[model samples]
Target: MATSSGAPAARTFFGHPWGLATLFFTEMWERFSFYGLRAILVLFLIAPPADSGLGMAEGTAKALLGVYMAMVYFVALPGGWIADRVLGARRAVLAGGVVIMLGHLSMAIPGGAGFVYLGLLLIIVGTGLLKPNISTMVGKLYQGQPDARRDSAFSIFYMGINIGSLAPFVVGYLGEEINWHLGFGAAAVGMALGLVQYLLGARHLAGVGDRPGDPLTPAERGRVLRIAGTVAAVAAAVLLIFAALGRLTVDGVTVALTVLAIVVPAAYFAFMFRSPEVSAEERVRLRAYVWLFLAAALFWMIFDQAAGPLNIFAQRSVDLNVFGWQMPASWTQNINPILIICFAAVFAWLWVRLGDRVSTPQKFAFALVMCGLSFVVMSVASNAAAGGARVSLLWLIAVYLLQTLGELSLSPVGLSVTTRLAPRAYASQMMGVWFLATAAGDAVGGQVARLQEPWGDVRYFLLLGACTMAGGVVMFLFTRSLRRLMGEERRAVPSAV
Candidate 1:
């Protein structure tokens, strides 16, 4: 069992206790590795040969990014399956860390394109295994309605993600600016550290990820085989089709993703609509959750830009001056995590104080608006930069603050909502699908990020901000109906007899 860090044990820091610190630190390092590579990813790819890069075109870089992110999130579907049915969450997470470490190490190696691509493949596969399972473990830590502290727990966990995110900028500063392989090497080391800590903490986990030790019943075993077969068939079909078309690039990939985007969710809805297993009201609620998932995806599409175009914009246009020191543009990536740690507590407190009054739908609505608003700041900064040499760093900070608040409102809630709303039999797969939606959104964001304007940076920001706000407004307009559909705010009032 992993020993606690000498911190006092309480009923709930917000709502959870054991395994949090374990998960927190584990996720922290994991994010550190993930985001560290991400921080310098585009910069490295786009950097001039004078700076030792392949000097790939922006469109190609974005396309590669889309494919990379799509693979990462898409693989999670199978990863979640393995966690639920075979390896269990604990082993899956550890295995994922190892895979990621290998990937990062591969990236660290010099002069081998095959090695670099292979490393990316490894990292993507590893993330698929680790990401959803670790999150599943976090959900496992709570049972029933997890009270106000649940958000705080997620916030703390969220901080770990940011803590991990913060390291990349530092690593990027040192590695990318000085030595490219160094950054990749640092990411590998980070994952290795995560694997070690996760193993050390295994004892504290108890029943969390303990898989069913016995051989599966014939029916369950058959179901597993069926699912695996279905997934394999689907993947094979998609790849064969793609190969035949001779169409593989940013546009081709995006079109495929967009066209298929509605299919999964739509199929899920069709299944729920036809199934007799669930009550009609339950179906309504499930449908609402699906919409929430869609809206959440839209929000992430905009917010995720922080790592892509926003990172570039910050590096190029934003002025970072503090006490006679100019912070690297990539360092702005740290701001979101820093704010997450600070506001997580406050947001948790707000929920505690406002219990039952604030609906999940409302939170979702807030997230959408915040995501949209963050883009506006980006637009404003871009516009301002037209006249001036450098826009104030404060604009970047403002955007992060809004985006973080939006994230605080919705992101953690997503895990809880999915676990609560999804059917018992479909828990892990459902979560995987939810994450797959995220992958879809990320793919979209990558496409949008590449489609810059004639006015350069200003056009993308304005379009993104408007689109984000429009999505939010659409959600808000439907808020009452959505609330009703979700059955989220209902209270058992006494009859007036």
Candidate 2:
């Protein structure tokens, strides 16, 4: 292991730096805590009070979950700002770990809805602090490495993600089959274990994320704080006013957050473009990123539904009877993770072998195609289920399989490319920008998914499926321009049309 003096990490763990191993397990546990709770969250929400659940309405619960997921990622902009200007990425990650552990522990308590809401609030803030910064550190670890190697490294990193995602199976089992609080406790324990190991491994990450990349001057700090404080106060006042008027419903809050998810990013993009700090070359790349970001947002809108309407559908429509034994519906959540584990490495190797022969836009196009096809298949399944049939679990499995392939295509590549296109001044913040795509997708997707009630599942699935496929076609048309924009002054970018 390297020391805290910021020496270069020894190349280990299949030619990548030793820091990757430290970060890898840390992320593994984080994902365990995150996905484990998520797997059973909707189930717990819809579960009656008699069953020790919150008993929220299905539409409301799903909306809440979608909005919650979006907000968690949406707040990453500030999280990245905190890292860039105040805490430093390393300390931000540590602070985030502690906060997340506490959040899970809070949820573990058997008490009123306040505890649950408080826990979720903490988790959202904590994840904002951790997720983007940790990924930024991963990119930092590969400073001076080839783009292909970095891309492969991200895929390997994503493997850790999928490995952690496997927790849903165990956590869901405990929550659904036993006590929900106990399941929350298990997630807390997982985060605790991750934190302990992270502390021990800190030395390996010494040079990386050790201090703020762009520390604020004392004058700048004071000005920013004043603005931030004012904004927070006004936001809180509005929320209080809404509550007083009895307009503070879950649906209302969800809709509000969803609108922010759209507007905030638009405003942020304008800020970045005008910030004299962004070089003209960086501006060109950012323009290319706008296109990619839109594609990614669409991809996530479909992919994230795995735990929302999709999870609900699995419970209600899919056959759980196997060998005359019923499996927990949440187990269906594991299929994508399982597939990710099995194939992410294969795709990583394939990308490495191909190098920049294929452009990132082309990859995204393929991913959209896969996403669309998955939904198309899902439409068929939903139709059968609506016709009063407990369709075979294989139907759902196939959807996950297609989605897992699409995820490998877009998610890791998106991470790698965001780091590449980012201006030097906005390094960590750029990672936050990447997560905003997910926030936008989930926010819009949540509202779009609610249409299933009025339009029926078949129509809802087919509509999204067809639209996404059209997005893939449009993506292909822009690949040549995107590649040229990305390749300026670069040796080997993702390549051409």
Candidate 3:
């Protein structure tokens, strides 16, 4: 509705802009498709061929899962660039949703590994285009709004994510207990519904995410395409040569990607440190961010295994039999989201009530300690299951509860800290860097999970858990220094609440 001055009046959905509602549902469905597929990805890989599965080695399957998870984030940087430069965030989101639906459909076909790989590739590409830009759109919705309102809007948006993420228990059950292809198809339908909702709500999204923030000139666009084509051709040629030499195996590809994910981010940080664009104070903050980044990576490396080694552990070691019924192992992935929904508000209230009493580094220290303890508990469970006895379902539930605490401590705080510490010139890119921490961590975790094949699960849980607690202790030592670097005024601004 137009105001008296021929300008559109601000419309609100539950007190925020109406546009937020559109973006919120879009993101919800996107996450629904993503978490749904992830819930069953490993299960389908290791299931017996006679059970219509791939019959892949457990190590290979896990490594692939890690690489796939890493690639989703790693690819998002370029994806966001493309959305900002060419398609605009809105169109990119629509295109991405369509592509994701297609990806799920591809996997649903009753072919072999080839179609599954094709599906995964499509999902990655679609997600790359869609995931980051939608959040960008959310930010756009509150262009001139105060920080507190923006934060509240995001809280509402975040609830959509957790709500969507709960699809795994529902979709995952069908995939595990009924038919795997059916589950994939259901994910596709979820995306389709998201697209439908997005289209219907497009009228509400006018003046946001509708144009490139920094569009390239036509000549620049051509140059970019040529460069991209050349890079792709050369990379493909190299892969073909390796394929002919029989060295282009899955492990080889995963190793190369892992190296790429870790090394590129490290090199970027080094360049940023030396750049004249960064002031001395900014550089000091960047140094602090470096520590935080490592802490975040360490946190995610353990946390993200919910779909890989942890899932396998639940399948092999947890008694899925409930009272009189047998529960699907994939349903285990739903616990964290359930906990998040139940307690996200309580955690927020605690942070608000505590105010700045807790520093960012201190919160991260808490996360590391709790993450370590979760695995320590898992280590005990692993030992108990050593002789092929299934432990009670409460064991995995306990681990997820601890990790959820760790996640609430770190995830939102990590974002707030990164935004606070980023240099002005590279403010947006630093958000991508925050995701890079996850990619690097997941890539490394993939490689680490491979050790389970040689070292076994009990030792794996015990050793990593011990090391993580040590990491927490080290972070606590540096807490005062990091708080100083973030600036005294920032310290007084209260915690991320």
Candidate 4:
């Protein structure tokens, strides 16, 4: 057991520190808001103006959603740095929660497209601040505990995320079935509840996240501020110039972000590999990680399409009839989280029981294959749709189930490997580098989904599925060498949800 501030360890929540409960619930609500809004974002965009939506084209809507998602992850790099060197995790989380609340509220107000854009900007900045820091604080709760305990705490915290992800069923139903603003308002309410609990449970976290991991001295702080200010000014000026030239369209912004999302990770890898700080052994591990990163990106590119094209598929092509009622299309988005909650424990146990029978690289290969199969399911469903028949909702549910399994295989393993292989001096930066993989996946996935309009559903799904399967095969062939690069010893598997 780990003690906080030199006091005896107290087991207040399920034999874990009380702070875990606070952070857990806070994160749950934050995720509830995030996923809730995401579940309905594209649907809201494509809905007719008569339905209180912006009446945007489906392609444009998907592109915008992609850009927003990419930015949310991309900003985490600076957000983590700010928490570690400036405001500390606690204050950063608080400030982030406030901004997130305002963002949701702004969206809840039925004004114009400007409100939507403003809300997204605030939520992106707020998520950048909160997402990485809250997880850091969870680790702090078990600071001096054994690795087992810390791993257990993380498992509990991950459940909070899955539980929160379920909120889209409720919030999404409201937004898609009733009114868009109302759903946004409900998300705002969820965050408000989180903030209230966070305040009430402040006592449990007395010694945690109170200060930065590495605070800056006065001179260093001044220099950083100056640099940040200069960069902001230059960025603002460039944006203004683009807007004045009538060139700052949504398509333009999406293209720019897509390029940035791809380029940043490549640049990070180049910098890390070339840096003298990385040992030869660490460099070998980094090489292995790069391969894993590419596989992870491919998996996410397919999996994350759930929120864009899949949502559209559910609404337009799938039969939504239940026993006696037609369900809302947003309800389809709930399948993945629901399945994750149901099967995560079973997968965790299977991994432990199987032990060295499955290596990390092997798991990545499995995930890629599973992801391709999931899309294959969708491809078949699209064939049915092409015949002018609305496929059973069960088809979509099957796709989600397969994709959820793929997610379980890859996501947790990737997190553990990144932590294990990261160079000590660049640990945080390495974590940011890992997130860049997701940024690339989302940006590219969105663009790929856009192809559906031109390529048609059958060809789009088949092409993506075939390409993904090929990638998996290539990864499988390379797994032996990658595992060698990871070193010969079988390491203990870290806990992942």
lDDT tens readout by residue for model 2, 1-497? 67588886566856777788888888999999999988999888888999999988877887888888998899888998899889999999999999999999999998967898889989999998898789889989888879889867776787788889889777888898899999999999999998998898888885899999989999999999899999999999989998998879878888989999999888988999999999998998899998999999999998999898889888889999989988888889899888877886699789988887777898999999999989999899998887678999999989999998899899989987998899888875787888899999998888777787788889888999999999998988877888888874254554455
Q: How high is the lDDT of residue 156 in model 1?
A: 70
Query: Model 2: runs farther than 4 Å from truth?
Result: 1-19, 139-156, 279-282, 353-357, 423-428, 481-497
On TM-score, the stronger of 1 and 2 is 2
Worst 10 residues of 3 by lDDT: 488-497
Clashes of each: 3, 0, 0, 0
By lDDT rank, best first, the candidates go 3, 4, 2, 1
Per-model TM values vs. the true structure: 0.85, 0.89, 0.95, 0.95
Error of 3 at 240 (Å): 2.1
RMSD in Å for model 4: 3.6
Error of 1 at 401 (Å): 1.2
Model 4: runs farther than 4 Å from truth?
1-11, 489-497
Give the range where candidate 4 is weakest over 10 consecutive residues by summed lDDT: 488-497
Q: Write the per-residue lDDT of candidate 3 for residues 1-497, one digit (tens) a residue.
A: 89999998888888887888988998999899999999999999999988889998988898899989998999888989998899999999999999999999999998999999999999989999999999999988878879888898999999999989988877888898888999999999999999999999899886798898999999999999999999999999989997998879888888888999999899989999999999999998899899999999999898988899889888888999888888888889999999999989989998878878878888999999999889899989999998899999899989999999999999998988888899998998888899999999899998888998788787888888889989999999988888888784454764364
Q: Whose lDDT is greatest here? A: 3
* Cα lDDT of model 1 by residue, 115-230, tens digit: 76788889999998899888878867775645655545676787678778788666787665687778889999988888887888777776788782234678988987898799
Error of 4 at 182 (Å): 0.5
